[model samples]
Target: MTRRTVVADTRSFRSDIQGLRALAVGLVILAHAGFRTASGGFIGVDVFFVISGFLIIGLLLREAGESGRISILDFYARRARRVIPAATIVLVATAVASAYVLPLVRGAEVIKDSVWAAFFAANIRFSLVETDYFSQGEPPSPVQHYWSLSVEEQFYIVIPLLLLAVAVVVRRRAGEAAEADRVRVLRRTVFVVLAAVTLSSLAWSIHVTATSPTGAYFSTAARAWELGIGGLAATLVWGRAPRLGRWATEAVLAVGLALIAFATLRFDAQTAVPGSAALVPVLGSALMLAAGSTTGASSTYLFRLFSIAPARVVGDWSYSLYLWHFPVLRLCEEYWEEPRLSKPHLAVALVLIFALSAASYHLVEQPFRKGVRWRPRLRAITLYPVSLAMVVVTAVGAHAWVDGQIAALEDNPGIAVSDYGRDGLSKDPTVALVEASVLAAQDDRPVPGGLEPALGSVRESVAPLGDCDYRTGTRKLCAFGDPDAERTIALMGDSHARHWSPAIDAIGREHGYRVYVFVYSGCPAITFTRLTDGGRPWTECADFKEWALGQVRELHPDLVVLANNAYQSAAMKKRQVGALRDQLELLRPLAGKVAMIGDSPKLPKAPGTCISERDVDLGDCLQEPETGPTRIQGQFRQTVEDLGMTWVDARRWFCAEDRCPAVIGNVVPLRDREHVTVEYSTLLADPIAAALGIAEG
Candidate 1:
């Protein structure tokens, strides 16, 4: 009822926690800034999770202890005031900046990402997309960092209710017990619940990280344990400090800092994270908090060091810094068209990030969080829905504007569409015509008006291989073309091979042949021990390849088609060429004929994005062909040809006179930096069939 017990700050503020916040944000910034030593700096987010769990649950527990009940309204009001305002500003600002600075295709993506972030569902959006946070080729969404905040918000929503439920159940069970005993029982019950959650989530995190690393990285279920560990620590050291000696407390603090440092320096993009591996930083953070909660721990040198003026200042602004850095750095990279920012650009970006964080902290975060003196007490809580509505409106506006721009580009009179008569080098007239159109468009002409799979939707224009079983050793095929056709052909490889389905399906239908698809996203059909993006051995790929080959042998299809991106074979040492030859030899005995589609020319940028950004002079998006197939690709080609298997020279179809245009026959060739769009792949059917010497129906 009084000021002391009305709010949840029943415990005194710990400046060391502020220092930990500074540390967490620093690690994340350094990692994202491309500091090689801080490669594992992503663990900083795990540290933050631990800190949030400790602070939030501690607040809830303290309120229940002092006031005999928890005010869910007050808890949510504090969260809305402290979090929503600053987050909304970042979301809106990032959306506006993305529309102006990013390519039109990426702009659309950012808008969608912003909408998800506004609703506090950014993690869900990212998980659904299977966004590999560590991916080298794809640009991170501007709002990607919001995923961590989303996780925390979700935890906040549930933790209060959970604590309240525990308080209610304990009071009911202890109706005649003293107040002291009632509070004690409630805390103990909550501790058990937190422990159960921690262990179960940790187990799930390890399993999911192994099976589906990308999704696991963004999953709340996989990450809840980190926060639970923090909550458990808070519950253990709630009212009284740990009774350890000063020396013991200092030792705990030192070990905690060491663990954090080790993870920051030793971890890299290849580490499967927020799993068992994440325990280092999560536990380290919890230990640091727990150590400070010990008697006389605040006087320790480690605590004093963390509480220093500079560290505390940075920590105070840490939230704004985290929100602003990712979008600023990402957009800078997009502007410069460099995967890594140059020194000057990097320096400029740092300046801008700090300046913005400081301004937002003072002008937006502090003003709103502290509340206006004249405003009604409950008015601030309305910010939750208001901020969400503002962000959604911004996203909707951005989406419509992008669509309008694409439509306008499509209406340009200079654009050409001749119904794409097939004629050129391939026996298939359509393939030849498409190639000729591509070559003609190179170094000239604006993007054609009637671009297939309009630029706005091109990024999602991936071939549909959703029904195919990507992991199993068993033959689970997604059939295409005439299913009842007498003749049969099987397509097998990685995503690159999968993209060829549209074209393959067309060829199969024309020639009265049935098509069976067997493909996985990152798994190559090659027989080498492949490392996943996380640097772990990919045994599933090997298993699938073996089973697919065995099935091919049993069925002995009329034709077997194979292709894979060069990245799959990048890890092969001296055995790349040998591996291909061996794979070919195995296939020769099983299939009537074997053909390998050479990996497509690697584009410098995403074609849809390039076209969207340079529609006025589409020639700007033309790629000057590289020397030839990469070393791995060349080796695969030579071995396939040497083994007498048909090797399709795909470059001729995408490039001419050393110039490869982003679009051919009014079609965007690729959905992203790699992987052909289904529309363009469908156009390549005749060329592929001609190369394989397959007769027309």
Candidate 2:
């Protein structure tokens, strides 16, 4: 295709759309910056999806309408020019900043995330990792915002091919003389296709949001409907939307703005989102776009306001602003060790964000878009191969570097067992002795060679045995520690219980007892009903708990060890305590002895990410362990004591008299915010066995 043929649609400025961009970006910034009123400002991303669909689909339809065919190469080249340059600059810069500001272990993960973002596959990577977008304990990735961009890029890739196919079929049927009829047929066909996709995607969004809200948030399938809604609008009424009277335009604009405002102010992280709730913002945005398109120059005051220079200027910088805000906010949070910013600090950060956005928009984004000629021949000859090579090289290099670091750590035996206090183990172990050893080894500096090597090895040490580990639905029994042994000790509960397996299994092996691992992800061992994060009944957990109770009775295990991370809302504390009482009462009659381990200290942040060798002091990363018994722990102890069962308070092993150190005896204590590292868990074997009345071998 010639340059003239490909460039059939000239770019025209739309002040209203630009204003919408500004509003969307502003809401997102406010929301991310911890403004209480903008809790639902995250919906701004949904607004962007609609706007993108409208603009991109409009261009393709216009091109096909004029030339009777779409230039695939030219379309891709235009996308590359518009998206890649600024994204690359931001990705590289974020990677460099992460290495300096973040812990080495976390920095390695960010590098991987940056590589995924560079290839516009960050959404897929995040989904694979099951990263919780709303999690508070885990530090957010600097490039987490790239997930939406990835979804949009994926849409761009698919939509053009679909439009081209529709155009081909329309032309083949109608012939050259009936070009107008062919274009009309293509429009109708496109509208029908978009409508179907919209409904299908909406259904999927609702279903997925109900079943798995976190997954739904990052899912392309769940988000596609929003874009399809915009595509439908473009196909049906690009330039020919019916003109509306001033009164009607004003009403539409008023209602649209109100809906968006309600959603922005009312919705929060706990709100079910990307489902029916998302329709508030999506439909509101569509209404605003429709009204803006139909309103005349002398129409409504709202239309005039949106067309003003200030909104347009912000709109011009909106893309860069959105790109810059999250990373800047994340950096600020990392430095301060706080999620919320003070007013003065927030104001300064916003100023910095705007300055950086302006520089990126002018120096990187606008320059590349204008200079890069999107001619079909040039793009096919140069851009595609070069872009693909950059993506491949970045991803491969990052993966290789992380792998090498992990491998070096794994090969060094000294690093694995360093400062473990193995010599301190005694026949009669106590929490006080464990604390003494840890406190004795405590140092201001981070572990030697940083914590990445230890953090990387953590998973391997605690990972459930092969295929025997139960991940979903019901429980699967995984046996360890001399399976042929007559005396069986059962370890039960969710991942909190699973974290203690390294020590428990070691104890079982030494004692000539078989250890049966029966744990599920996120499912606690409780008698009362519980809900998943998505607000559905945790049926699998209930089912597994019931089944395990029966199995324990049948097997007549010599000992049953129970544990759970019972940190929950104050409202549920009473019910959770009651449930613990009920579970303990039931277990008392089934096993020879039932022991309940108290929950570990829930750290303010992931220890791996919080502790670094570069820091002058540990700072707020070291928190004082709660002096009094936790409400749940107190309840558990009371319930177990009432049932005449064993109750082990293991908190002293994790925290000392004043503070809980992130690293104890050259070992990072936590794999994440809540789970203890296997190396540390192994250190607790003697103390735990002592608590269980198990004598040393």
| Root-mean-square deviation of every model | 3.7, 4.7
Model 1, position 616, has a per-residue lDDT of 48
Q: Tell me the lDDT of model 1 at 624.
A: 65
Per-residue lDDT tens digits of candidate 2, residues 154-189? 877788998899888877777865766777788888
Which sections of candidate 2 miss by over 4 Å? 1-12, 174-177, 295-298, 336-338, 372-433, 441-465, 468-489, 505-516, 532-559, 588-593, 617-622, 626-629, 686-690, 693-697
- Per-residue lDDT of model 1, residues 1-697, tens digit only: 0011111222666888888889999999999999999999989899889988888888888887766678998887777777888899999999988987888899999999999999899999998877889877678998999999998888778889888888777767888888778778878898998898889999999887876788889989999999999889889888666678888989999999999999999989878887788999988998999988877777799999998988888888998999999999999998887789999999999999999999999988888766474144377678878998999888888888878877777765332334333333555454455456555565466676778888888988878765675653455666688889988899988888988988899998988888888787777666665675456667777777777777787778899998877753345645556766777787788888899998877776777888778334666777764443455678788888788779887867676666677777677788887678889898788767878899541
Which pairs in model 1 have colliding backbones?
422-429, 422-430, 423-429, 423-432, 423-433
lDDT values for all models? 0.80, 0.74
Every model's TM-score: 0.90, 0.86
